[model samples]
Target: MALVKEGDTITIDAHARSLHLHISDEKLAHRRANCQPLPPRYIRGVLVKYTKLVSSSSLSALTDFNLF
Candidate 1:
């Protein structure tokens, strides 16, 4: 877990297997104590299809940040 002040943004890997969140720490304790549980919502995932050459060329183009 990471602690950040307002206006800060943190990134986490969604596919990471060994990730853990420690709420007992002082920073997160308040959130754990006050928040109520909510039902999970369903979100549709997007699927992309790319051939070998197409993916390689796309990745090469992506090296230039302005493309996106």
Candidate 2:
């Protein structure tokens, strides 16, 4: 997947079944290199626990009970 910066323009062609991001490769690479992981939103409690244990939705969001 390509990184799209804020305010970047995107073009979607339904007939062509394609999407394009109007960003230079160099700029995208720079953004990727400087990107930082966001801090977890939940500090504590059930939501925190859920985040730690839940699997991706494609995997049915199954909680790994063994992790608890």
Candidate 3:
């Protein structure tokens, strides 16, 4: 999100299953270095628990039972 700015071009290739950001490597590196992590939207309850317990979707969205 931080890497993308207004007027920046983006391409989505469904067939290739890829996304392209039309920005220079230098610009991307600069954006990455300056990017800040977003604060958690949920502070408590099931959502918070879910956030802590769930693994990344790349890992198949498995819950870490050890967190329970």
Q: RMSDs, each prediction?
A: 12.6, 4.3, 3.4
lDDT of 3: 0.89
Candidate with top TM-score is 3
lDDT of 2 at 65: 47
Which portions of model 2 miss their true places by more than 4 Å? 13-19, 64-68
Score candidate 3 by TM-score against the native: 0.71
Tens digit of per-residue lDDT, candidate 3, span 1-68: 66898999999999999989999999999989999999999999999999888889998788864644
The TM-score measured for candidate 2 stands at 0.71
Q: Tell me how far the alpha carbon of residue 49 in candidate 3 is from the true structure, in angstroms, after superposition.
A: 0.8
Q: Which whole-number lDDT from 0 to 100 does residue 59 have in model 1?
A: 68
| Model 1 alpha-carbon miss at residue 44, Å | 26
Tens-place lDDT per residue, model 1, 1-68, is: 32433554455567875544533466567655666665435333332222211335646734345657
Error of 3 at 18 (Å): 1.2
Candidate 1: clashing pairs of residues: none
- lDDT at 43 for candidate 2? 98
The lDDT for every candidate, in the order shown, is 0.47, 0.83, 0.89
Error of 1 at 65 (Å): 50
Measured against the true structure, the TM-scores of the candidates, in listed sequence, are 0.26, 0.71, 0.71
lDDT of 2 by residue, 22-48 (tens): 888888789899888788899999999
Q: lDDT score, residue 19, model 3?
A: 86
Single out the weakest 10-residue window by summed lDDT for candidate 1.
45-54
